[model samples]
Target chain A: MAKTVTQEFTKGLWEEIAPFRLVLGLCPVLGVTTTMENGIGMGLATTFVLVCSNILVSILRKFIPAKVRIACFIVIIATFVTVVELLMQAFAYPLFLKLGVFIPLIVVNCLVLGRAEAFAFKNKLIPSVADGLGMGVGFTLSLGALGAVREILGTGMFLGMSVFGASYEPFAFMVQAPGAFVCLGLMLCGMNIIGSK
Target chain B: MTELIKMVVVLVLLSSSSGGLLHWLKTQTSSKIEDQQVKFVKGPALKSIFEGSSNDPTADRFTLKVGETEKNFFVGKFDGKTNCVAFEGFGKGGYGGDIGLMIGVDIDNGSVLGAAVTTHSETPGLGAKAKEDPSFVSQLKGLSIESPILVTNDGGKINAMSGATITSRAVCNAANDAGKIYKEIKSQLTEKVKSF
Candidate 1:
């Protein structure tokens, strides 16, 4: 049976997760996600770009030559990234600063290009859009999970809201770069275990 | 020749578009971006000092004036009694970069109330440990005002994180300098009060 648009959308939630399941976009997943909000913001912004870029690339797929497809895709992705960057600065200035260079770096995030080439170029417009949404949500969810663990342990708080009172001690290493790896490693392992079941 | 021209055209189009878009973005977002970065670095520092605390009336800095010297600080009061002066200072040689500390010192007793690392680029597992372990920081509490600053090896007070000597020294010095500056400022203020 042919896959439905909804199936495409749902697949990214688990089976096709950009970082967790697919192992794509590992750099940003492991970086710029010290806080839950930062992770959410980055994930959602990436998703927005993925969805829009996929749709545009798919629509223009036939018009572009195979030899220069990568260049074309990059130009499209970069434009969307600029748009996302500007919008975030205008509306979500604090989150934008927290994201730092990661916002612009999204242009090279492999997941967007991977989808555009593998799925968007071949699939219909609706399926490509769904895939983008699914992947984005999956990425967002994973980042939020990573952020939750880091934030809570790192500063005894969640999303800047204190979960642990003054008496509660925080583990500072959990918020550092090493902590990002530790958390992501354990999470990926957990995801694998659940996926096997 | 047409193909070469087409390639050049594409390249130029791509370059101009990207450059134009980036320039537009910078123009639109530079102010907000600057404001956001300032908030990102300073917001938490402010919260660590003033959140969940009150200002002391007798404190001159509480009125937000430092005279010509132009230093800014916050006063924390508990039950109308001046509890602490949240003072900030920096250390020159931390393991990573300059370590910034916000220290709360008791106004009456002149002892430390608490301390927080407001900024640091210290190595994750090692130097950053200063911000974590309370047992390490508890060494600073109730220590006398004279030479309250120390390293674990020197035995004055304050436990140092193992293998993070530079960071340990930096934070300790920061706390010490903050306390010392507060004392100097407080004495000056008192002299002014006496003269009046």
Candidate 2:
């Protein structure tokens, strides 16, 4: 039982990330992540929503009938997402605008709903929370990794801080939309290579 | 009968509670969000154009008679100086849908001081970079009314992003449109000020 718990906690790190592996929630992952700051902001917001929704869904799992389960799950997820959105606005307003609607759209993020239906509904409270945390971290890392690549090559910068001197012209396209796909695909490929080994 | 009642009750409670929670949350955060919006995005975009000014964004729209064309726009003024002026238009469609940009123009001159993505459904990295890149935006600064608003590839002043030709052109086009309006405004205002 303890071994299974540990696996659930760690599984999100590599085995079942929303992006890269399962290939879920690609919109916000790619949309807001032009810089490391944006990626971190988006990651933490999504994580907060995931953890809260997962716990709520798990607690109400038995009470919620299977036919209405998805609707119940959406309501729970939307509540947590609103909280996350409000919290970001209250405290991290700059990051909030930077993130834009992607924050509210967390309600529909496959990762949050996926966890509620997959692990949270089936697991106990502690394990559900653990799974959410693990998955959130995995998603965050994925966004951060993608942001780092785009920022560095596209602008010779990282997280808005300029790393290169005036000599650099910066590959302007690397920060553009095409660069986002190329970077994400290459990163996923790299992750695949590492995982295989 | 019992099961149906229970299902109805549960859905009612769930939806009402969710709506109530969202309403409460929005009420609590709306003011803070508006303040932060001024402090961060709008403020910074304006500061990049005008250095520093108290951010007081008015939704007031103005029609500047630029020759025959009457340009309408939202002006962000800081302490009497026009910090930034924002205007919107559709971009050439690409892999992403229509790209919309809010160009912030500096008052000292009609130069593009800063800009932001008002609306976009562009592809993840390529077209979206126009919003994310300061370099792409920076090129707009210090731009005079005399400068042609074309990309470097097309023998223009601004640099276009690799693999994002259509997107880059779209942005450059907005800047050009704004720059043209600015020229007419400058000439009109200068003549008006001289007459006074």
Query: Over the stretch B1-196, how does candidate 1's per-residue lDDT look in tens digits?
Result: 7666665666566658768877888898886765554355544554554456554322334322344555445555566555555656777789778888876666666777667777888988888877755566556667654456888587756667889888889988888777667766776533333332
Q: Give candidate 1's whole-model lDDT.
A: 0.76
| Cα lDDT computed for each candidate against the true fold | 0.76, 0.75
lDDT of 1 by residue, A93-123 (tens): 7777689799999999999999999999887
True lDDT of residue A8, candidate 1: 95
Native contacts matched by each model: 0.30, 0.61
The alpha-carbon deviation from the true structure for residue B174 of candidate 2, after best TM-score superposition, in angstroms, is 17
Candidate 2 lDDT, B1-196, residue by residue in tens = 8777777888898889889988988998887776665555444444454445454332344556655756545555567654456554445554476665566665556666666555566666887787777677677666664366778888888788888888888877666656665665665544332331
Model 2 residue B56 lDDT score: 38
DockQ of 2: 0.43
Tens-digit lDDT track for model 2 on A1-197?
A: 56466788788888887798889889888788788788878998899888988888888887887878898999898888878878888888877768888988988888889888888998899899889999999999989888888888988987667888878899988788888888899888998899999
Expressed between 0 and 1, the share of native interface contacts present in candidate 2 is: 0.61
| Model 1, position B65: C-alpha lDDT score | 37
